[model samples]
Target chain A: MSENKTVLYSYWRSSCSWRVRVALAYKKIKYEYKAIHLLKDGGQQKTEEYSKINPMKAIPTLEIDGHIIGQSLAILEYLEETHPENPLMPNGAYERAIARQMMQIIGSDIQPLQNLKILGLVGQYSGDEAKKAEWARTIITNGFNGLEKLLEKHSGKFCVGDSVSFADLCLPAQVYNANRFNVDMTPYPNITRVNQYLLTIPEFIEALPQNQPDAEPQC
Target chain B: MSENKTVLYSYWRSSCSWRVRVALAYKKIKYEYKAIHLLKDGGQQKTEEYSKINPMKAIPTLEIDGHIIGQSLAILEYLEETHPENPLMPNGAYERAIARQMMQIIGSDIQPLQNLKILGLVGQYSGDEAKKAEWARTIITNGFNGLEKLLEKHSGKFCVGDSVSFADLCLPAQVYNANRFNVDMTPYPNITRVNQYLLTIPEFIEALPQNQPDAEPQC
Candidate 1:
C-alpha cells in the first residue's frame, strides 16, 4: 500500500469533500484530486466504478497508499495518524475529546441534514422547499447555537484551545454551505467570528469551493 | 473534575442516549441516570432547564465529575480515556482508526438521520409514517452496508480486531432501532450475526432499551 499513489474521490462543492481536502492540505500531504461531479451524470457517486471505490457511493473517499478510507472524520483521523507531525487533535485526552465533540456537531449533527443529496430528496418527496428550508434552518441554528455556546467555553481564536484542530477544518465549509441555503448565521456571533478568522488563512481560503481546481466561480 | 459523580441525562428510547449507556456499562463506570423524556409535553428536551444543561436540547448529556459532555461518541471516548482498564480500541494505530471509523458510521451516519426528534419532525411536517420510514430505511441500509463491507476487512469476533471497542458498543442499539422501524437486516449477514452475538453478552444485554430502568414499552 505504501508504494501506490494518493488519490481523492471528491466533488468540489461537497462540504464533506471540502473538509477532507482542507485536512490533506493542512497536513501538507500531496495527493491527486479526482473530481467526481456529483450533479452531472445523474450523481456520479452512484456509478458502478465509483460505487466500487465506495459502496456507500459517497464523495470524498481518500485513497492513501492504496488503503481506502471513507467518512470525512475517519479520513481526517487517518491523515493525522499517518502524518502525526501536524496533529488535528489536541494533546491531552480530555482536550481531544472536546475537539471531537465539536467536530461531531458539524459532521453528524448539522451537515447530514443539510447535505445536497438529502435536500434533493426533500425536494422530491415533499415538494416543500419552504418547509424543508425551515427544517434545515432550525437544525442548523440549534447545532450552531450549541456549538457557539461550547466554543464560548474553550475557543481561543480557534474552535478548540487556539490551535487549528479538526473542528476548525470542518466548520467553515458547513457555515458556507448553510449560508447558500439562506440559513442565516448573523444570530450565531461566535460562528461568524470563528469563520471570519478561518477565511483569512491561506490554507482555508485556498480550500474553498470557489478556489478548488474544478471550482465554478473561479474565486 | 474527576472527583464528582458521573450523571447521564438520557431519554429511554433515544439511540443517541443508548450509545452512551452501552459505553458506560462496557467500561463498568458507575453513573446516575436522569431520564428526560423527548416526547412528553411537547418534548422535554426543548425546556429551558434542560437546554441549560445541553444547548442542543438533546438527551444523553453526561456530567462527569462536573464536566458536561453532549455528543454520544465524544462521551464514549471520554469513558474509554478515564477508564482505560477495559480498553475499547485496539493498540495499533491502524486498528484504532478502523474502530473509530466503524463508530462514525453508526454514530455519525445512521443514528443521526433516524433519530427520534427528526422522525417527530417528519411526522409533524409530512404527516406520513410510510415516507418517514422509507427515509430511515434508505439511510440506515446505506450506513449498515458500508459497515458490513468495512467489517469484512476489520472484524474478528467484534467490530474491530477481536476486542469489543466503542464500535461494538454502538452497533446493537443501532440495529435494534432499525429493526423497530422494520428495516430488514437479512441482507447484511455479518452485521446481523455480530449483533446477535453481542446480544448474549451480559453487559450489552443489561444496556438494552427493554432492560433499562426507565424504558417504557412505548419508548
Candidate 2:
C-alpha cells in the first residue's frame, strides 16, 4: 500500500506546482496534496518539516513510497516513466528531444526570470512596477518568440510532433504566468492555439490554479 | 556516410556547449566541431545561417544524420536514446528522475541568471558591476545550496545515485562558471569531490573548454 501511494507538497498558485499537478492528472495517478502557502507568514515552505522533505523548500515535492522528489520537470519525467501506459514522449529519439526542448524553453528559459524571488528583486531595486513588468515581459517574449518559431516548424495538434507530450503539460501554466504580467499572447498563434486546446483537456482543466481547493475566489 | 556523421555546432568556452561536448565524448562518438564564436562581432550564433540550424540561436546545437537538436538537456537525452550502448542515466525510472532533477537545477535554476545577457541586464538596469556580481552570487549561492543538500542525500560515485548521469556533465560547467566570478568551490565538499572524480574521467578531461581548437590562447 505504501508503494502505491504518492504525495505531492504543492502551493496553490505556483506555476511549477501546477506543472506537476497537470502531469499527475494526465497520468491519472492518485496522490495526496499537502498545501503550503507561499505568502502566509513569509512562506510556510520555510518550515523545518518542509525543509526535511525538500531542502530547497520549494513546492511540488513528490513523495513516492516516502521517497521525496523535487523539481517540476523531474517530477513529470518520473510520472511518465512510472506510468508508461499513456505515453507522453514519442517513440523516436529525435521526437523526444523535440518534446524536452519545448519543455526546457518554458522551464529554463522563461520561468526563472519571472519567478517570485527574482520579481521581488526587480521590485526592490527598480522600484517601478511597470519596469518590473517590462523586465518579466522581455524574457517571456524572447523565449516565446523562439518557441513560436520552433513550434511553427514542428507543432501539429500539440507541441512536438502532434502527441500530448510533457511539453503540453507545461504550456498552459506558463501561458498563465505570462498572462499574470499582461504578456500579449495574441502575437503567437501557435501558443494561443495550444493553450486553448490544453484548456479543453480534463487533466489540464482541473490543474488550473483557479480550480485548486486553496484558490482565492474572485469577488 | 552523412547519416553516420554527427556534427556539433559549439563554442569552446560556452558552458551549454560544453554539456554536449562531454556527452558526445562520453558516448565515445566521433564528430565534427563547427566553432561558432559566441562573443565575437556581436555573436556568431545570431547569424541567419546558425538561426536556420537552431531557432534559439544557442550554443550546443547538435546535427546528427541531417537532423538537428538544441537545448543541452534535450541533446543529452537524445544522445542517451540514440546511443544506448553507453548508458548515462540510471536503470530505474525513479533514479532517472533524480538525474533529470539535478540537470534541471543546473540548466533551469542556475544557468540563466548567470548568462552573459542577464549580467548585461544587471549592468544596464541595476547600474553597477558590483550589483551584477551580487545578483549572480545570490542565485549561484541559492542554487548551489539547494544542490548541495540534494547531493548530500543522492550522490554516490556521482550525482543522482552514481555512474555519471547528465548531472555530472552539468556540474562542471556550472562550477567553472562560478569560479569565473570567483565563487568558492571549497564551500561545497560534495561538489568538489565529484568534480575531482569527474576530472579523472578521460572523456570529461578531453572535453575541457581549454582543450578545444577554438579556445583562445592566453598568455
Candidate 3:
C-alpha cells in the first residue's frame, strides 16, 4: 500500500504547534504543512472551517491515515504509536511517565497560562501591555524554575536521557517562548544547557518557529 | 511482589488531581490519598519538601512503583501502562488518539486557564472578586462550548466510545468546576448529558470534589 497522506495544520509561533512540528521531524515523517495564522483575519483558528477540523479551534491538528486528531500531546502520542522507528518515549513505563511529567510541566502548567486567549484577557483586565507581558514572564519563569529542578535530576544531554525523547521535543519550543517573554535563563542552568544542546540538532532546529513556512521576523 | 504502595498526592478541588482520582478508581486500583491542601500553610504545594516531590508543586503527583509522577496525565498513563486491567485507553491508535485528544481539551486547554494560579493573577489584576470569577466563567464557557461540539461527534455513553477511557476521567471534574464557576451549562447539552451519566457511576461519584475527605461546602 502507498504511504498515508499527511497534513499538519500549524501556526509558527504557537508552542503547541511547534511541538508537533518537532515530533513530525524527529520521526522523519513527511507531510503537507498548512499554516493557519493565529493572527490576521481575526485569528484564523477561530474560523468555522478550522473549528470543524479542531473543535477547540487549536492548531497542529494532524490529518493522517484517513482521520484527524487535535491536541499536540495527542498528536505526538499518535506519531509515537504509529511510527515507532525513532521512539520519543523511553522504554519502561516509569521512565516514560517521568518524561511525560517533564512534558506536562510545560504543556499543562506553563504554556497554557501564556496562551493568547488568557494573555488577551489579562491584558484587558490589567489595561496595560507591559503588565500583560509581565504576566507571561511570571508564568514562564515559575514553570522554568520548576522544570529546571526536574532537569537537574533527569538530564543526560537531554531532558530525560542522552537520547532525545518526547520531553526533549517539548523543551526547545518552551525555551524559545521563555526567551520571547524575557524569562531569565540564569536561574535555569540545566534547562538552558539542554535547550542549547537541542538547538544543535537538525530535527529540533527545523521545527523552530522561525523556520516555519509562514514565519515572520519578530519586531 | 506485594502491591506497591501507591500514594496519590492530591487536593480536593484541583481538577488535575480529580482526574487522577477517577482514573485510579476506574481502574479499581487502591491507593493512599494524601491530601495537600492547596491553600493551607502558604499553599502546601510550595513547601520545599513537596517541591522535591513535584517541582511544579502541582497535585495528582502519584507515588507508585517506587517513583513519583508529577502530572495527572502522566499518572493516568502510568496506571494504564502498569495495570492494564480494565484498560482506560481504547484499542486502535486512531481511536486512542482521539480519546487523548478529548482528555487534552480539558487537561491542557480548559482547566489550566481556570487554575488557581491564573485565577489569583486575574484577581490581582482586576482588583475584585467578582471580575475574577467572571474571568473564570468566560474561560470555562468558551472551553465547554468547544468541548461540547467535540462530544457531539465522539460521545457514546462515554467519551470516545461506550467504554470508560482516560478522557472520561477528565470530564466530571471539569463539569464540577464549571458548576462551581456558575458557567451556564445549558448551551452544552452533550457535555451535560455525559457528565450527568458519569456522575451516576460510582467511580466518578466517589471522586467528586464534595465527596473528597477535605471537601467543604460552598456558601
Candidate 4:
C-alpha cells in the first residue's frame, strides 16, 4: 500500500486515536494524519461531515485501501492482518487470546468508562468537578488493579511476551489517561515498567499525544 | 476439549456472558456452565475464589484445557481460532475488520455505557431513578442510531453478512438490553430487523438469558 493512500482521522489526546497511531507507527505503515480536533468547534467529530465518515462520531477512523474502518481495535486487527511482516500478535492461539484479553480489558472495560463523552455525562449527572475526577480515578484504578495482576503473569518486555503486540499499543495510551485523572500508578509496577519501556521506543514516542502535529500546548 | 474440562463462569443476565454463550453454542463447544450471580450475595463474582479465577471479577470467564480466559471478545476469538470449523469471522481481512467493527460498536461503545456497573454509578451520581433511566436511554439510543446506519450497508441476515459471526453474537444481547432500558427502537429498523431475524436462529434462541439453567424467575 502506498503511503499517500492511507489517511487517519485522529485527535492528539484521544486514547483510542493514540492506539491507532501507535499501531501504524509500529507497523512502519506510512499514513496521513488528519487531526479532527475533539474539543474545537463543539467537537469536530460530532459535525455532520465527520459523521459521514464514522457514524459513531468518534476519532481515529482509518481510511485505508479505499475502505473506511472505525474503532481502534478493528483498525489494529486490520493492520496486523494486512501488514503481516511486523506482526502485532503472538503466534500461539492461546497466547494470542491472552493478548486480546489484555486489549479488551483496557479497550472495552477501562477506556470506555473514562472516555471523554462518558466523563462529560458524569460531570452532568454529578454537577461536581471533583466527583467527575473521582469517577475517572475510580474506574482507572480498578482497571489497573486487574491489569497489574494480569501483567505479572504475561509481561516480559511488553504486555504479552518479549515481542510488542496490540496489548503494548494499548498500554501507553491508557496509562497516559490514568495519569491525566491523577490515578496512583504506584500499585502497578508491571504496568509502569512496561509503559516506561514502551515510551522509549521510537514509534511509541512519535505517537504520543504531545508529539502529534495538531497537539495544542498543554496547560 | 472435553466438556468436563471446560467450565464457563457466567451470569444468566450478563450481556457479555450471553455473547460467549451464543458463540460457544454456535461453535458446538461443550462447556460446563457455572453461574456466578452478579447481584446475589453482594455479587458472588466479587468473592475471593472467583477473583482467583478472574481477577477482574467479571462474568463469562472461560476455563478450557487448564487455561482461563476473560473478556467475551477474547473468548469468542479464542473459540474461532480453536474451533475454526464453525468460523464466526468472514474470510477477507477487510470483511473481518468490518465484523469486528460491528462487534466493537456493541461491545465497547453501547454495552459499556449501559452496563450494570456503569448504570449503578449513574444512579449514584444522579440520585434519582428517573435520571438514571434517562442516562441509560440516552447512551443506548445514541449507539442504536449509529448502529442503524452501519447496518444499512453491512447487514445481510446478520450484522456482517448472511451468516453468523462475532457481530451476530453481540447483537441479540444488546438489543435485549435496549428493550430492558425501554429505548425507542422504532428509529432503528435495521437493528430491529436483524435482531428479529437473529432470534429465529436455534443457537441464539438457546443462548437467551431466560433459557439458561440459572435463570431467576422474573418479577
Q: Candidate 3, overall lDDT?
A: 0.86
- Per residue, candidate 3 scores C-alpha lDDT tens digits across B1-219 of 124798888888888888888888878878888899999888999899988888888787888877888889988888898889878888989889988998888888888888888888888887876787888888888788778887899888988778888889999888888888888888999888888889899988889888888888866
Error of 2 at A204 (Å): 0.9
Instruction: List, residue by residue over B1-219, the lDDT tens digit for candidate 1.
Output: 255888889877777888788778878878888889888898888899988878788878898866878888888877877788877778876677778778888887788888876776666667676778888888898898888988877787888877787789889888887887788888888888788888898888878787777888764
Q: Highest lDDT among the candidates is held by which one? A: 4
Rank candidates by TM-score, best first.
4, 3, 2, 1
True contacts preserved, each candidate?
0.62, 0.70, 0.84, 0.79
Docking class of 3: high
lDDT tens digits by residue: candidate 4, A117-187: 98888888988767888999889898888888999998999998898888999999899888888888889
lDDT of candidate 4 at residue A167, scale 0 to 100: 90
Residues B81-187 of candidate 4 have per-residue lDDT tens digits of 88898788889888898889889989998898888888888888878766877888888898888888888988899888787778889998898888888888889
Candidate 2, position A160, lDDT: 78
Q: Compose the digit string of candidate 2's lDDT tens values, residues A93-141.
A: 7888888888888898888888887888776666565678888898899
Clashing pairs in 2: none
- Best candidate according to TM-score: 4
For the record, the alpha-carbon RMSD of candidate 3 to the native fold, in angstroms, is: 2.0
Tell me the deviation in Å of residue B213 in model 3.
2.7
TM (chain A) per model:
0.94, 0.94, 0.96, 0.96
Assess chain B of each prediction and give its TM-score.
Answer: 0.93, 0.95, 0.94, 0.96
Instruction: Return the TM-score for each candidate structure.
Output: 0.94, 0.96, 0.96, 0.97
Model 1 CA deviation exceeding 4 Å by range: A1-4, A129-131
Sequence-dependent TM-score of model 1: 0.94
Ranked candidates, highest lDDT first: 4, 3, 2, 1
